[model samples]
Target chain A: MSDLSVLYDAPGPKAKRNATIGSVVVGLALLAVLYVVYARLDEKGQWSWDLWGPLLDPSNEVFELVWQNLGTGLRNTLTGALVAITLSLLLGVVFGVARVMLGRWARIPVVGLIEILRGLPVIVMMFMAYQLLPALGVNYEPLPGPDAFWYMVVGLTLYNLAVFAEILRSGVNSLPKGQREAGLVIGLTPLQTMVMIQLPQAFRTMLPAIISQMVVVLKDTSLIMFLGQYPELLYQAKIIYQDLGNTLQTLVVVGIIFIAINFALSQLAVWVEKRMSRRSAGKSIDPIMATTAAPVKV
Target chain B: MNVIIDNFDLFFQGFLKTLGIGLICMVGSLILGTIIAAFRVSPVAPLRAVGTLYVNLIRNCPLTVVLFLIAFGLPTIGINQSYYFFGCSALIIYTASFVCEALRSGINAIPAGQAEAARAIGLGFTQNLRHVILPQAFRTAIPPTGSVIIAMFKNSAVLGVFGVSGDLLGNAIILTGSRGFDPVPVYLGIGFFFLMITIPAGLVLGYLERKAVILR
Candidate 1:
């Protein structure tokens, strides 16, 4: 059996420093928490530590209600992220390739579309989709919820598609000219040349960037709260935290949920990047590896 | 033309509200972004962690979460401030994350030695950051910041969704719902309104980018 010690081990100096600093940070954080409790109690006119007692009691109805809301919100949030991320990548790759390969005549229009849509905020786009499409008679009936969810998803698809296209374009542009010539010499059609040769290589370089951009789209889903229906996690948090009159307390759960989820997504991207780097690493060493020791260096 | 004249004052007021929120948040976020970026790039591990946590959380979290939490959640906590205060606060907070990330990107664009050189010349950290490192980072930061500013302008319209007293998009929604007018004109109007703010802002930012190049 292989020992996983090296994989699990921490960097020694960094860990030592982090441990000392982490303790102090937690200590200061506790003091701030105590202050918030005191301030909140004073606001309620009860002015006692007894209020925090209920928070520790897990079985309280209100806490249960909040948890139920959070659970549902997490489900919707995850589903929306999955849908949008998948669509965004597909659209991004298509647009990016189109942008790069467009003749001089068609390039400006595609590039312009990318800049304009990319410049618009995702929230505004969500509003347009939710509020605008129905008004314009573009209707899609989903399971009984005023079309806001679908609109939000489609809007996300549009905005992210634009940016992803630009990212793809940049990736394609960065490819050396030799690849294109080689593909053409092999008698491939222009479309085939791109589909088989250029696109895969370009996407390899674009993967990390695409991951970061997808995180942006995933986070942007929070704005769907404005469509007058559908509560993503943040909306659910707002509904509860507002009723409780303890923002710091409520946001503790909400913020941590966001942080935890986002951190996981980022780590996933990092994992992909690491795997990609390793694969690319071998490609990088190939020239030297194939050189036959440079004819004994003489 | 008739509708424009009929709702001239509402249109003008809404325009002002959008301008007010966008400009204030833009400035506020840029300032907050700088401080956060500084912390992010700091040598101290905990400080860096705090910075990382903040950027990562805000970046992955949606803008509306921060806004809704402030607009609805803050009032229940006894803050209950005016719409302007709440709207701007949410916007500033939301924008700051993007700002921090943008400025950090700009910082990353600068060579690592620029700060060390400034320090080598006997400048203090703050002084070195302000005088030497920042000027260069601002250049690298320009393209992203330009888009960020445009984003801020566009997002300002969402204040309507939060039920702000006076804002372009909310006002349009109100007009559409209550007045029973066609939604196209109003949305088209709002789109034009945003384009007015963003397009010029985009051009100016682009100009500044070129100007930075020439001056540098």
Candidate 2:
């Protein structure tokens, strides 16, 4: 038997009988629980088609009423995620390479910022960006729009910047020592070695993690709705619910949209991983294995 | 700082509520995660399918959406409760998938021989898991589990968005609005409280990880 199958014995006739009985019992229990839950929902009129009507028909007036708002919300969400992800990747590369070049003592400030930002909640940071920065007389305007949107972008960038730094640092360190040594032997400065030889390879090696963190940035845009009028998908859904009183239906649709986008991104990460391993003929270390050795920062 | 001291009761209550939600979700997610992990590795095909489906769906969805669903969806299904209840429920649901994945990784770390040895001694599946596999698996699982716990703690702050009162973030917002004080100092205090919770937990988990490595 393989590792996963070791505890699972090959079933003798009696063991097969027991296994069948156990399956039946478990199946019945599941059915019973589902039935109870369904009955409760039905009794509360939750199964009525009226609540789901607007969503089922694209031609409904309700859809028309909310369509513009939904578009705006979707646009803002994408903008926030894209901007933050791009900025963080840039920041991450710089700091990650710095952390590697500068020893522990020299990198104290960088390391401290990463640790603190990683520890702080993204929502709290957004709050600080939205209210505190303005109070402190900082321009607080990264983008020329609503303060909430910029706050979200800034907040998300900071947290993700730190996380990607650690990921990239580990990614760089995981590379063969000879890669750096070879660059130095060619008369390259440390910065040149990193810029020319190491950072590019580290990024390729860490693509799965970087992509997964992009998915995180996308999801975090939802938190901006908490800040007020920051019309992301979640905010749009909330607004629709406030207008239509179909809270469950609105949330379900919004959830489906999020799940679809995130699922697609996750699948892309996996596909890239498979393609990379195949191209390398399994020579490159499994990127997932490397990144997952640490607690996933997202 | 003056704002923090002057409204100490508000901050304390919020702190307690935040901790309460964190504790509740921690325990709830652990139990749910164990069940899901068990389902995932079960011999029954249907059970495994269910477990896989649950994780695939939940892990991809944002916690905000999940929280919104629970906060509003459950009311339609006749289980109306406070925003606090919905917040805790959402945290448990969202975090359980990560916890299950972590535990599954731990379970995978076990050598096949240990499971085989247990079965050779006539131990059944549950017995083998409890007596032979899980204890060893958990030693390796501690770090990821700690990360999930810390994540859940940070996520508890999202409860404020749904108008849940008495959470650290929520009260900070409330008090800032009510007292008409500069939000920077209030938020600074709030951030410190979160760092206090997360930093120690990180250190402890780091220690445990080093200790586990030594034992290995």
Which candidate has the top score in lDDT? 2
lDDT of 1 by residue, B1-216 (tens): 456567767777887888888888888988888888777765445566778777777766666667656765566556778877888888887777777777766665566566666656777545776897678877866767667666778777777777676787777777777877566666666666766777677678768767776242
Fnat measured on candidate 1 = 0.25
Error of 2 at A164 (Å): 0.6
Model 2, residue A203: displacement in angstroms?
1.7
- Best prediction by TM-score: 2
**Ten-residue region with minimum lDDT total, candidate 2 chain A:** A280-289
In candidate 2 the C-alpha lDDT for residue B181 amounts to 79
Q: What is the TM-score (0 to 1) of candidate 1?
A: 0.79
Residues A1-298 of candidate 2: C-alpha lDDT, one tens digit per residue? 2256677788789878887887888888889988987897788776677767776667777766676777777788898899999998899887777777898699888777788888888899888788777776777554335677788888998888888898888767767888899999999999999888888777776777788778878988999877756778888878877887778777777778778888888888878877776542123433323334443432
Q: What would the per-residue lDDT of candidate 2 be over residues B1-216, giving only the tens digit for each residue?
A: 788899888887888888888889999999999899889888876688789888878887889989888877787667889887888889899989978877887887677888989999999988998998888888867767777788788888888767788789988888778768778789988888888877777887788777775253
- For model 2, the DockQ equals 0.57
lDDT of 2: 0.79
lDDT of each: 0.67, 0.79
Measured by DockQ, the strongest candidate is 2
Model 1, residue B192: C-alpha shift (Å): 2.0
lDDT of 1 by residue, A148-208 (tens): 6777788788788876676656556657777878999999987888888878876775566
